[model samples]
Target chain A: MATMMNSTVFGTVVPHKNPTILRPLPCSLEELFCGKVKNYTHEKKIYDSSGKTFTVHKSTLQIYLKPGWKAGTKITFPKEGDVIPNIEPADLEIVIEEEPHPLFMRENNNLILRKNISLLQALVGFSFSVPYLDGSEFAVDVESLTFPLTPKVVQGKGYLSQRDGSAGNLVIFFNILWPKVLTEEQKSILKKGPLSECEYLGLL
Target chain B: MATMMNSTVFGTVVPHKNPTILRPLPCSLEELFCGKVKNYTHEKKIYDSSGKTFTVHKSTLQIYLKPGWKAGTKITFPKEGDVIPNIEPADLEIVIEEEPHPLFMRENNNLILRKNISLLQALVGFSFSVPYLDGSEFAVDVESLTFPLTPKVVQGKGYLSQRDGSAGNLVIFFNILWPKVLTEEQKSILKKGPLSECEYLGLL
Candidate 1:
């Protein structure tokens, strides 16, 4: 009888709004498992933290993205690990580490984006479009709004909550951009209209 | 500021002799995240321990897979998780669960297989071919062998070890098959040849 053990590996994949996700593996690695890969040589150049570089030779392997595969995804290759002399080889596992997105922020299946709008737009109404995590564009219409600090929400437009089958809402927060320098005419115009209420409150 | 939390999900990938690994996600899941998928509703049917079936439609999601995920793989769908009212969605992690292989067994980074041979072959000499994990054929030769219990080994033909970045060996064990019944003519033939040495032993 042979003792069974497992080996784990980590990997990362960034998901776009599209349904399909793609991951590439070294050709040498594929050859290591598949024995051969036609005519191609598997090789990769990598650098360490100290800027030391090395070359790795392996066949290329591609992992097709499936549903339920997201950041922190872990997969195991049974009996695909090391050899212990007379015993059996262990299992191999692959873990994933997703790179952070630039435009969107996540919070428990909810998507958030911070947008900047002119003071006039914040005071009146604003309409804009933002990209969803899935790569789709969503138009946000802010109606009957006077404050920019409050966030606008679109129901069923956020992330898909794995916990509940429903989609979360997409929230857009507006940051009112105030003029860095105001001309006398602009100040007078502001004071006569939007600023009139502040003046009346004696808090301007 | 949004509180950052990571949701870990486990998945499974069966390792073949090929380099590519594949995983599939449900179409409903994609629709749930994308906010629209035509007229089909997103509903999951699940069976409980008591053998009761139920339909779930709350948008709450849970991924269930036996065993555990390996290391070295990551998938991140930004803001594709829970909705915290006004906050962003949490990150979703899918851990992998590797299915076991049928023919070969593992131990660390080594691969093992067992084979059976006739008693005549065990006593004289035998040669055969076996499939490597990577789908390659390797010939094993046994010469000057009297015992049938010993194993044959191929160096550096096992699994790749992550600790040392080297491959292990492939092990083959032999099992001697015995005849259920012996005919008088066969017995006499055996007694005149290979059995001649036993006659020198007083115990025989």
Candidate 2:
């Protein structure tokens, strides 16, 4: 069978150098899902050996974002290139830049978020809610005796994969926060309690 | 001082899959040098699991080409891309595909052409004209005892480099073509002659 010709090019949407959040600034999740259009301007200057400058090309451009687009997702445009004389104008490829998200790290299609919890919660059990990429909140339940630095996974809650268009899991890593100082009474209580193993090692 | 934003997005003007010539078909060197605008159309389709296909997007676009544009040259279009929400639209980048030319080959900014010459021309001297990229013709002189498969260079007759904008040289390779058969009279006339070292080898 004859193959179809590719009429569009791919490009990356890069994130800012210092991104403060996982999502784009001033944009809501709903806006990203529904797609958005923006106006942009670009300029260049050519300098000679004598430092004489020439304004080469400058103009404003329109950037389009489709619904469900994310970092590393290629945005394509049709017939947005040079004229091929008699044939057709080539397509433009926009490779979405794989910029690091400030609050969330990406692995394949999965999203990773790290959170700190109290020592008590790590020993017993805890329940909490985290913000999903879609702006909705999802609850995370850590079972009793859940170890600090361990990861708990919430399946099917991650960024959409551009390769297969499937969603991935959201992994949460727990960091235990220990009290910096203990009162005399608290230290005495711990010493007489069931922490004898630690007391023998002078950790009490 | 604040830095200036890039307003122009660079894209490649890809060569044809089977490029017969350097310039695109139906395009003259004059037209390429003067710049031209041509109409183009693009289409795409979406298919379901049941093989139900639907046309997604179709549009006619205007493709612009500037003068002195060649294969591997980047063309820029200002403000031609998707619009970002509240922010400016992103610029589109076109990457020209490096395709093989049937008659001429490219290396960096230089051009290469190979031609075949008669055995007599390789032993004696010969001269000929070769076509330049800019539609001009230049003469090439081969000195006596020119070796086969050796290249003769013509300076300042190559593509303009996008980096430095300086021109390069054109290199020509010679291929010697031997006569298929010799008649008896021709063979006898050469047998009784005063033979040089090479002539003795030929006779043997």
Candidate 3:
């Protein structure tokens, strides 16, 4: 269960002024936080930085910090599933404006890390995200699918041949083998997984 | 760590004379199996069916089962990163294409278990891997970052209404904020922390 994953802040979060309680809202919990709000009958109350917490039955609230909300500020939110029993806390999780993976980052300063790795190996983490291609939203197990073995760089050859007096180039070639098709339901899951809270499927 | 996962297999996996182990390889061990190979370098040798065990050396082996390497023909490979003692069985892991996740496969049907679980949560019991994305990849601690007051899902309501009502959507979103970048050495550690066999800079 120990995994190191890279993520970014979506917005600025601050400390809560008053002790507060989180209640499960009506409708689907996943729907409430999928990075997009659709339809809901009730409003949820969020504590402000001024140190006051109150029950407000509104779908949305304008959040303010005593100091203020600043872009690029770091904050954290506690997971909804756990709440300390009879304890006062300002339990918080950090936030960031989630940007696309650095692989697709505007600038590829990543070359520093790619130093001696084979082009194939350097790009191993680059997932085609089969779901991304179908215009569907389901998560694809990139690990489960097959990749074509098109080895371009000869083994034992350094990526930079000219630097060490050998046939070297800064590239590794490999091809991704795409799956024929995925179910509509699977597609939807991929598209929405990163944007919303996942709901519990009775099957699980 | 506790994980929610399930799988069941009904039929038996028939072994193949030759099984190719794909490589050039990705950052993760799992990618090698799912990838294709041009020249075969290993033959399939099943050690256990229920345990999904097998071995491959240097040979042209096809992963497809049945006539070539089809479903229903269960094959076995080593658990990821598994190695033998001085025996030095081989430097690489083997892949048996016929083998399927026990829980995900029921008889002839591939079960669609719940999706959208965080990568960390999903990695609990099974031994699988993916390419390593070097960045801040932890979901548990956000001591150095701040979060936004309003969660990101505020814009998803309209989209959900249009989707078919059979299944709901799920999204896993996180925000991360960093005040500054670490030294190049620190960046390398973060990307390979969980899997690296070396001591961290602090430890040394």
True contacts kept of each: 0.00, 0.00, 0.00
Interface RMSD, candidate 2?
51.4
Cα error of candidate 3 at position B153, Å:
9.2
Among the numbered candidates, top DockQ falls to 3
TM-score for the first chain in candidate 2 comes to 0.57
Over the stretch B1-204, how does candidate 2's per-residue lDDT look in tens digits? 111233333574322121111222234443443456755443333333333443355555565755445655544444343222222333333433444555677676667888776544544457988765456777888654445346888887765655677776888887655334344443333233211112111111
Model 2 lDDT per residue over A66-168, tens place: 6556655544455443222222333444544444555677676677888776544544457988866566887888754445345888887765655777777
Candidate number with the higher lDDT (1 or 3): 1
- Please give, as one word, the docking class of candidate 2: incorrect
Name the candidate, 1 or 3, with the larger DockQ value: 3
Cα error, candidate 2, residue A97 (Å): 2.4
A93-122 in candidate 3: lDDT tens per residue? 323232333221111111111112221222
Score every model by TM-score.
0.34, 0.33, 0.14
- Once superposed on the true structure, which residue ranges of model 2 sit more than 4 Å away at CA? A1-70, A78-91, A98-102, A194-204, B1-204
